[model samples]
Target: MADTARRTDDLLAGLPVPGARSPGQGERAAGAKNTARAARSRFMAAHGEEVYDRLTDGRTRHLRLRELVDAAAREFPGLVPDAAQLAQESARPQADKDGREIDQGIFFSRLLGSPLAGPHLMDAMLRPTDRALRLLPDFRRTGFADLGSVTLERRGSAAHLTMCRPDCLNAEDNEQVEAMETAVDLALLDPAVHVGLLRGGEMTHPRYRGRRVFSAGINLKSLHAGRISLVDFLLRRELGYIAKLMRGVLVDHETSWQSRTIEKPWVAAVDTFAIGGGMQLLMVFDRVIAGSDAYLSLPAAQEGIVPGAGNFRLGRLAGGRISRQVVLWGRRLWASEPDARLLIDEVVDPAAVGAAADAALERLDSPAVVTNRRVLNLAEEPPEAFRAYLAEFSLQQALRLYSEDVIGKVGRFSAGCAAPPA
Candidate 1:
């Protein structure tokens, strides 16, 4: 565990700082008129002419731009190809004999934004063009690169769960959701993962919701146009996968379930939005740290959808009435809401959200095992069995929670509509 903690710390140090970039780089790329020119200039400025020539020389030898950037992007996340390479890749036909040269445009487009021509530009580059080109990167088609979804970094007795999806606003499409379920299943199966923290990046996009994004729920971008058609198929697949992962976690509990190893209490602090599937993940944690902006909402209703399988889990944790109110209406509920007060233990200003979460985590009693057992027992069964449930069932409680939703909905609406539309 000591070694694991050290390694985890080192990994954090090595990972590229998110949103950290040279000034003018992002503004240029996102600019309506100068995006392409900016991307090209930025590429040259960052990679000296010497390196550019070396790359082009290598490319002439049939090296694909995707292959080169994917190698470099491991260290530099936002880097792009040179203009010369981009033009050549785009000019090469789909049936070109040289696979690497022709595919460069596809790779560059996916990493950066696809041209205004279409989002599938990047997908076409990296995948087989025959069947894959016809189907955009969605539920029906997946990336050829077998990118794993969840990353686990063992720290002392608890393993920190890193929910990584660098693209698509951290959205949980069918593939990402499957990855998260697998990570949790691993934690549950391995008694060593006594605690877990589910989290998301602050700036996630292409499927962004305003300026904020949360891991609490699924991002709408991941769902395909025909997502409704495949609900049953997706549901069955997820259930089977999640069940197996959970079974693995619970299997060895009878013995070797030592709990005193971790010196810290289990906690998951949600930074920004924790909506949709992200909120479902929060339920799996024992203690939650929420930010002022960290209101919970189920926007699926706005799109004429329900949370589906995750609904039961949420209802089990929050009182059934409160859960239904949130999901059915798809309204945002804040800390002041009567039901929200009962649902979330603490709410702090955005400035204090992180520190507050750290404080809450530091105060929990340990042996760690006892705390976890209590939480699972409290949350696992239907809320009806707990004394907490009775308090939640009161008509007075329902009115207050619902009232908060109304006040928040009317008073706290966005000042203006989103630019691209959600």
Candidate 2:
């Protein structure tokens, strides 16, 4: 996001150092060389040293950082990491874990410089394959006012994303969306994570008491209060990490190029309800295990704005006609119905949904799962066609955001809420 402003090398050099050798001394060069050797030693021990040396041989090690990043882009895509996960994993090498390339993209920036840094990081982060993404250093949300809405925990070969805005039935605002986006990005990049589980905060908030509700959709209170801007909404949904993606793209891509579907399977455990934006997200989940009494609906018609990307993805799950009713006519989909059950893979007791999701994901943890997912994605939702639909959806959504109907809806929806959030 830095706009090529300052010369990074000069900036790093000009900064005052404590107890350091004088400028232009070979000491710094020796230090950098030592770092390079350490990286080589680790890579070699892990069976990738030859690949590293071949790519970096005779070249200045710092200058060669780009080649590793580019290799990850070409060969591993979304798995090329930025920071937090790598830092955590590397910090405890004595702990058992899978081996991977030097995952920190900034290692290159610190050594080679920013001009070389920015583009490679961008490219590595933007790849659509399962491994395609770069986390910010410390790897939290990028453009949000708060990060309390979503939390991530890395488990062995799994990442758990917990949505925690239970005060609004776990409703989403720009902050929540941004936080969830980073959570998903972390799961995609971490080689240790082969599965992801998403669920709600439940008893985490006082207003909800002890009840568990998956989500109430977009935070109408936030939208009405002007807490979320039209630009933030559009950019995040259209181009940011949580953009509508074809599950099939992930499933069908080569091991190297697999998109989200093939990248890592995500299981959604819906406890109470999924409405509008919340219901819409199930379209991208590899598996959905919802409570028996849970309900799903796309109430965009009532909202007077598009329900996130629900309109585009709903039809693939619930047929065009059913989707139309939910999206256009405001139909509440109950988990008990055959139609609702069609979209959700399993229906379980509300309290057991998490266990059900874990069991389902465990069954899917196989070497061929990605290939199998790709096959399903290709057969069901081709990427090209889905992208075309998104293009149209985005256009209509932009117009809807600032429309008169939406302005009226905001007033009415806000009136029905508790109060403007503190």
Every candidate's lDDT:
0.41, 0.57
Where model 2 places Cα greater than 4 Å from the true spot, the runs are: 1-147, 203-207, 243-262, 416-422
Q: CA lDDT of 392 in candidate 2?
A: 48
> How do the residues 119-147 of candidate 2 rate in per-residue lDDT, one tens digit apiece?
33223323433222444334323221224
Candidate 2 yields a Cα-based lDDT of: 0.57
- Cα lDDT tens digits for candidate 1, 1-422: 22332333244334322134234643432242133334433553454333333544633422222344544434333333334433443353222111121122222322223122111211122222122123223311221212265565554445455555645445565566545544454444444444555555544443553433455444333222212112212332223233222222222234436531112234666666666656655554457777776676666555343353446566766778877777777767775565665556777776776567555544553555455554564457432332222222221221221232422432222222221222
Q: What value does the lDDT take at residue 186 in candidate 1?
A: 44
376 Cα displacement, candidate 2 (Å): 2.1
TM-score for candidate 1, residues paired by index: 0.46
Which candidate number would show the highest lDDT if scored against the true structure? 2
Model 1: worst 10 consecutive residues (lDDT sum)? 94-103
